[model samples]
Target: MLTTILFNPEIEHYDFGPGHAFRGERFASFRRMYQETLAHNPHFQWASHDESATDEELGLWHTQDYINMLRAASLAEDDEDSSVPEFAALFGCGPKTGPSRQSLSVYVSRDNLNPLTGRLPEGIENAARAIVKNSMLAVDYVLQGKTDKAVGLGGGLHHAKANYGEGFCIYNDVVIAARYAMKAYGLERILILDTDAHAGNGTCEAFYNDPGILFIDVHQTGIYPGTGLIEETGAGKGKGFTVNIPLKSGSGDAEYERIFDEIIFPLAREFRPRLIIRNGGSDPHFADNLTGLGLTLAGFWMIGDKVRRLSDELCRGKCVDLICSGYNPDVLAGAWISLIAGLSGIKVELKEPVPRIAADEPAEIADIIYEVRKVIKPYWKCLG
Candidate 1:
C-alpha cells in the first residue's frame, strides 16, 4: 500500500521555450501544490532520481543512431553554423511536413525546433534521459517490492518512437520502462493503460507485433498524431494484445469508467499481467489548453481508483504510474492529487473551478464500446 513519488529538479529543463504550451514550470507548480496538499499523507513518500538513463537503457526502446542524433541536437549552439535544425528537419522538427519518408515526429509538434536558432533546446536530451531513468526506477521499485506502487512524475513520454521523437516526446520512457521490467524481472505479461487525450501512437507502434505486452490506449480520436483506430489490434503474434478505444471528442468520466469496467478490467483479469503501467497526465480535462476531452478532477480520481483496484486484484498491487502530460499546470496539479489519492485508496473530494462538460450521447458511447469489444473479441474471453 506504500507509494513512491519520483522527483528530479533537472527534469524542469524539458521545456521547449517561453511561449510553448508545455513548459518546465509545470514541475515546480505541481511540486509546490503536491507538498502543500499531500505532503503529510503517510501513504506517500518521495524518491529523487540520481542519474540519467545510460545509452544501454535507452537502447531498450530507442535506436542508437536516433539517440546519437538527439544527443547531438541537444548540444547544438543557437547559431547559424549549427546544423541542429537540419538534423531536426531530417528527423521531424517543424509543423509542416518534412521529407517524403519522414518520421511521425514531423507532424507532431511545431515547437520541436527553436524559432530563433532552429535548434532543440540545449540539455533537453539530458532531461529526457533523466525521465527515462526515473520511470525505470519506478518500475524497479514496484517489481523489487520497495513499494507496492510508484509514480514517475516525469514519464509518460508515449509519443517518442524507436528511431524518432514525436509529439514533443524525445524518448519513449513508458515503453522503455515496460521493456525493462519484463527483461530485468522475467515477467511474461505487462499491461500498459494509456489515457492521454492524444493517442499513444509511438507506444502502440513499439508493441504492435509483440504479444508479451498488452497496451490498452483510450484516447480522443482525430487529434494530434491521429493513429489509434479500433482496427489496430496488435498485428502478428500481438493480435488482440493491443486494444485502442478511440472515443469521440467530449467523452467524459462515464464513458471512461465504462470502458475500464467492460474492457480494461476484463482484459487485465484474463491477461493476468505481473505489472500495470498507467500513463498520461491531466490533459483530458475540459479546461485543458490542448485537446478536447472532458475529465473533471473526480473523473481522474475514478480512473485512478479503477487502476488501483485492478492492481490489487491481479498484480499484488504492483503498479507504476506515469503522470506526464498536462498543459495547464494548475489543473494538472489538482487532477494528479485526486488521482494519487485514489491510487492510494484515500478518500478525498477534489473540487475544481471548472464544471464537467456534457459527454457524448449514450448511444454514441455504446457504439464505440461495442466496436472495440468486437475488434478484440477474438483475443479475450471476458468480452465474449
Candidate 2:
C-alpha cells in the first residue's frame, strides 16, 4: 500500500513556546525518528510544501470575523495594539499573563511570546495555515488516487471551531479538510474517527446538524474540554451521526478493540463512507503527560490496523491520517511509528520503556459500549 507522508520543518513555528505543554518540536522529532527507521521504505513517500491555506479556503468553514481574530492575534506585535479583549473573548481567546480585562491581548501569555525578544514568532499565522494546507493536501492525495492512504504530519487540529479556538488548536484543520472534501470533491458520505484522548468538541459542533458527516469521538471521560457524552448524539438531520464513546481513564488495548469491533465497525459498514479520516496521537498512552488513558504501543498499532481494515473494506483503501497530539515526545514518537506501520501494513517492533498496563478484567468500558450502542441504535440497524 502506498502512503503519502507530508512534513515540513517550519511547521514547528506553531509552538506556543518551549515551556508550554504543546511544543512545535514534535514535527522535527517525528521526522528524525522516521528517517532513522523507515527512510528506506519504498512504500512510504515524503512530501513537503510551505503553501499556507488561502482565506477563501479557510472561509469554507470559518467565519470572516473569527478569521480576523486569528490574523490580529498573529500580527499583533504591540506595534498597534488592536486587541479588543471582550471581542477577543467572544472569539475564544484565552486569558493572558494577567486577568482578561487588564490584558487586552489574545496572544499575551509569557509562554506565547519569545522569552528573549518578548515578541510572537514571526509568521506564526503561516505556520497554522501550513497545517491546514498539508492536511487538505492529504485529502487531495487520497481522493485523487495519488496514494491509497495519506498522513498529514501537521494536522488533526480538531479543537478549533468556526468562531473560536481551543485545546491549543488555532484552526480546526480536520473540519476544514472534511468541508473541502464535501464542497470540492462532492463527497456525500464521509466518516471522521477522532481517537484523541480529549473530546473533539469543535468538530462535534461543526457537524452536529449535518447528516453527511459521521463523527465518532473516543476520548477519556472527564477530561479537559469535556463535552462528548453518550446521549449527546447529533440533532436534526444529524441526530445519530455524532457518536461519543467516552472510555474510562485506565482503559487500554482490549477496551479499544472492543469499541472498534462492536461499535465502529458496524456503523462504518452501514454508513459506507466514501473516505475515512482518522486523527489523534499517542496521548492516550499511559506515559503521556496530559491524559490518563492507558493505551500502549500495541494498542496504538491495534487502532491503526483496525482503520486499515475498515478503509480497505469500506472505502477502497482510501484513508487520511492526522498525527496531531501527544505530550511525551519519546513515547509519542514510538507510538506514532507503530501506528503508521500498522496502517501501512509494514512490520516493525517497538520496545516500550514500561510494561503494558492491563485493562480491567471484563473491560470496564462494557457499560459505555452498551450505552453508546443503545443511543445510536435507532439510526443503525446493524447495532440492533
Q: Count the backbone clashes (under 3 Å) in each candidate.
A: 0, 0
What does candidate 1's lDDT look like per residue over 39-93, in tens digits?
Answer: 7788889988677899999999888777876775576443343333455644545
Model 2 root-mean-square deviation: 4.3
- TM-score of candidate 2 against the unseen true structure: 0.90
- In model 1, the Cα lDDT at residue 95 comes to 47
Q: Model 2 misses residue 323 by how many Å?
A: 1.0
lDDT per model vs. reference = 0.83, 0.82
Q: What is the lDDT of candidate 1?
A: 0.83
Maximum-lDDT candidate: 1
lDDT of candidate 2 at residue 375, scale 0 to 100:
89
